[model samples]
Target: MARLTAREALSYGMFGNAAMLQNALDGKANISLASRSLPEITRQLRDAIAKRTVSAEGYPEKVGQPAISTELLPWALFEEFESLAVDHTGETVFLPPGAPQNIPRWKNVTFDAKEILELWPIANQQIDAWMNADFANNPLKKRKDRISDCTRAIPCTFATATAAFNRSPSKKRSRGQRATNRP
Candidate 1:
């Protein structure tokens, strides 16, 4: 919900992209967040970005990535901008977003290659369960959601599951969901 409008605030920046990526990796959605209270969470996210302090409703204090990684951010205020990027070798290759080639340089890389390489293994070390025990009573997760299917039998490919997420989500959680779902 905060991401839906973050583009304007973030200025199409490579730094902003890195910031948002870290936010996703570090923060989990509050099961209690919904339309009735979305504005508060959006304010919290915006405030966190602006002030570098967090007080989100469902998270423990200081749980998510609050500081942006300056080294990972493109220098020259420039870096190869891409919708998708991969670390292929010594060079970082990226598919540019409709711009002419103007490679950005990272002047002060504080971390070494070993740290970057280790990140992949760390990310893959263990899979975290999406729906924790708190979601045991959620009608959506229990009956309407397709999430459980991915855990059993054959896994659904991205293409196969793309349509599953294409459906319009409800504007708000009904009273039934709110009374029961807590995390």
Candidate 2:
């Protein structure tokens, strides 16, 4: 996923309309929140527009288990569908399946997955530089690094611990007993 610039975020919040910013400042519109990724921003925008909130259901047995269940109002159902569509496609931009055929077209819209991936390294470098600059400018927010040392280690972690049980002594004795009992 692509990380949106602050300028892009401001523009998106206004949607090319100066009145939107004015409304937001005047408390007539909801304030937009900054997020680490575009998808997070989009979700926040959608939630703000719908006046909705999301809560985690519960943790599952495995590490990557998909926690299900969401509560959405009738009018906010479209946002739920959009979330499901994106999750299914594994893409940031997607049109929900079974969209109406007569839906209005969007102009000058292009889908370029490759372009997003190419900018990742540059984006990471820029973000790292910005973080370092911020830290230098503000000592109060300075963070510390922690290190830990392991004192003990176990041997033969992969090798089986018990092999005697697997050696079938009864099977070996069975062959010798059969030869002696043969008529």
Candidate 3:
């Protein structure tokens, strides 16, 4: 977003491209380019940059190369920025008045019941292959085993199937973890 805006701003004779890139690196120019609520995150980033603790001073102004790199930001500072970015998801939080409410966001879509039933064997085959190939090395084996169990226990409630498919069954009892829909 900042790069596009910086290019546009450069086209309008606002500032030099190198200076714009530097400002973006410093987190000073991109504040307004981001959502209103995210300005605080940008501000915090700028504060960190100004402290010289997360400096990217030697970056060159190459045309195809990126000016601002997150690699320069330390893990601690990155975590701090991430914590401040908790409120990152809101459809209309930063939009101006009269702006469109829905701008087409990505969502986790689930397969329909028919699709799930049809794909069960393929999924089970993949799981079996994984289990045979690198079962001991992969930490996902436990969850995959649960999914294998869930695949056999078809004609079950979507919630129960999903719970079994997604999670490794715990030794301790939990209310929602019970396979009430199991035949």
**Preferred candidate (lDDT higher): 1 or 3:** 3
- Our model 3 lands, by Cα RMSD against the true structure, at 20.6
Best by TM-score: 2
Give the CA lDDT, 0 to 100, for residue 123 in model 3.
37
Q: What's the TM-score of every candidate structure?
A: 0.18, 0.21, 0.20
In lDDT terms, how accurate is model 3?
0.32
Candidate 3: TM-score? 0.20
Q: Can you write out model 2's per-residue Cα lDDT over 119-177, one digit (the tens) per residue?
A: 22122232333334443444232122100000001011112111211221222223224
- Which stretches of candidate 1 lie above 4 Å from their native place? 1-21, 24-128, 137-183
Task: List model 3 lDDT by residue over 61-126, tens digit each.
Answer: 345666453223233433333232111121112222233333222111111223223222223333
Candidate 3 lDDT at 88 equals: 19
Model 1, residue 91: distance off in Å is 11
lDDT of 3 at 35: 23
lDDT of 1 by residue, 1-183 (tens): 232223212211211111332343346523231222323333333333233232111111123544333333332122223231222111222334453455442212222222222221211111122222213334355322444442231123443333333332442245576534443
